[model samples]
Target: MTGIALPSLPAEVVDQAIDWSIKLTYNRADASTMTAFDAWLASHEQHRQAWERVQSLGGRFAGMPAELALQTLEKLPEARLRRRQMIKLLSLFAAVGVGGMGAREVTPWQRLLADHSTQVGERGRWTLIDGSVLDLNTDSAVVLRFDESQREVELLRGELHLISGADAGSPGKRPLRVATAFGLFEALGTRFSVRLDQHGCRLGVSEGAVRLTPRDGTARVAQAGESWSLSAREATRGTATPQEVAAWRDGLLVARDMPLAEVLAELGRYRHGHIGCDPQISTRPISGNFNLTDIDATLDFLAQAHGLRLNYLTRYWLRVSV
Candidate 1:
């Protein structure tokens, strides 16, 4: 649907309106809650406008019954899923003044709103307030949470390389940690990289040790020169060498006699589209260091080196055949 552009609303106002909607509509908030909302609505005209826009947004949710605004959220998981729904609602609010949120653009809302993030094919490095160095891989997002208790990096999406700083040695004695969907990794003055995939979180430790605690499993210490795949239940050792694993930090993809299909899959993550190999050649061995800074050129080089033909239905859809 074409959006009707209205006067731009403040992000905080939109969020407040959404929070109120969630409490009032989904939570069955009490009379006292309603009274508080009333006072908030009357405090400023912008609040009223935000409410109107929220109501209008509800109308847009009519057909898509799964959205939080129209959901019977009482039946859903309370903590993580609830926050996920709220983010989804916020994304819808953001899409209002622009054109409708396209199907392809739905998943990146949280990433786009993160404290630190990189777009597709982009890599970035940053220094945290606590003097730590952070390197974000393509399509990555992270949020920092620092307090007296701990210094935490919340990996919302994609992969990251972190070198723990001296925050732990400070007066408050805060420990440094990284949180992923599967579990938390507490650093011991370590350098580590974490990548999230469908199965679980993949961790590569190069410097000091880190304590790995799965959400529902026992904690284990991952020592230097170790790579682990941590799911909610267990931590499995990975086979890749330390160099092959961390090569992306130098803008390279190191395929150590990796399968052709596997190579393509890794390359696909750095690009916009599907990169597939013919089934017959999918298991063929490929080995080399390729430049990730230019993916198309890398693909062309691979095709030449491997004697594979490239078929392109569109620039975004590519297939490799023998």
Candidate 2:
């Protein structure tokens, strides 16, 4: 049901439907509340459409206890959802008479609502009206908002690389900013890469500079040849090479003493399904340049060179051991 294609409805109407769902399913609504909701539903055809789509979100959790659903939502390792986002999602689930969910599970629907998105193993690039170049890594989604007042890119998921260009609008040089779940990045005519995962948002500046402001921390300037990791609470500075910063642009993965498990995890982003590493070899240091275009060949190389075994449980599932 979550995968059902739905008719497009206005954003406001969708929000209303979600709110109504929460009130009706999660709370003991008074008669007035029910009456108002009924009126809203009957007021417009788009409202009905929005409710139909949002209600499907809870189909899987409909039978679970509320406490159990909440526990499941809290334990989603891959979602790395913030506390606020988690609460909102929980409410959304409660609307459809369920509760447990993860951001990863909901991300596909989000991408469907995005202005730009890429499928698994596929990358994307676009030239903005301001002449800036925007690139999306595999399975990424973003919304571009460029108006007279500002130019903004909202990163919904995965990673993005951008090269800032002069905005020659009437007001001139509208600030180019990228908004992620963790914080905001204001570009300063620079080339930078940003990745959002369960951990946080990682920023690598290859050229010029970028101003990084975590949601709860003070602002700071990140110069060229610097890397920063930002969470909701703070920002940590790090180092990265130019090659490493822009490697994905050239279809290469540069592993600088990276862990075997980590390498497999990165490769998994380019290919579908699961790639598992045995715990014994998970932390083994691996260093090499691998081609991202052909993930299977790289996995084969790693298996033969490192004296490991590849167990193909299915075409969509592979395990590396011994």
Candidate 3:
């Protein structure tokens, strides 16, 4: 048996080539349509080497269920998945050359959403078309889709802070809407924070107003400097100051005599691990401002001031005890 000789490609160049090839494959291409691609490839030895590295990138799709692959790829950590795909493709290219070119078709939305999730402990700020801005907190995921009729954002997971944009040109433009686990929040040209926690959903209005309609019949209107929680049964509204609601944006978590357990829950969102109060300390009162960026220092401060002890089982797990 005769084996095809493959050219040596630098690791970086090979990676770029595989990425481009995967993109092209998803865009739709087959083995026989390589006339122009071959010409382009031969234009430079580097290009040829790159193409060689990328041609076999889709072997993972072989005999693998397309739906499973798509879902698995979507859930895998982006960096690690991409690296593995690149390595697989490069290996095939080195073994079989450009003759192997069977790649699965993945939709653009799947690719886009798969690429846009936030990293752990990382927050992001983005601007919308209507001039309003959005701040995504750590470990959050959102999908933005705009059309001629309306602008919509789907909160797939995690939390987001939205500042509604005023009507720019169209007087009766469709109102900006945010969909989440709690329900749908319709902004009345308002600024608010929407968070999804294990228990339920929380909304804190900073400026303007917001209308909350739950999956159930319960509904409520939240005004400036107000907060609300929506659950499966009902919506609860309360008066909360703007400073307290917006504190996280400035890298601080401020609690005003809140229960120790609740404060630990909020702090856990900004950290990589489980942060919980000891059963004995669950009812303790927690106050003062804690830095969101430095969880360790904040924990240390809590220990020094309140006689709480910081305990760590792993880098990703934390607990507070007597």
Best by lDDT: 2
lDDT agreement with native, every candidate: 0.72, 0.73, 0.64
Task: Quote model 1's TM-score.
Answer: 0.67
Give lDDT: candidate 1, residue 300: 95
Q: Which stretches of candidate 2 lie over 4 Å from their true place?
A: 1-107
TM-score of each: 0.67, 0.67, 0.61
Off by over 4 Å in 1: 1-107
Those runs of model 3 whose alpha carbons end farther than 4 Å from true positions after fitting are 1-116, 167-172
Question: How far is each candidate from the true structure, as Cα RMSD in Å?
Answer: 15.8, 15.7, 16.9
Residue 191, model 2: Cα distance from true site in angstroms: 0.7
lDDT of 1 at 291: 96
Clashing pairs in 1: none
Which 10 residues in a row give candidate 1 its minimum summed lDDT?
A: 97-106
Which candidate do you rate higher for TM-score, 1 or 3? 1
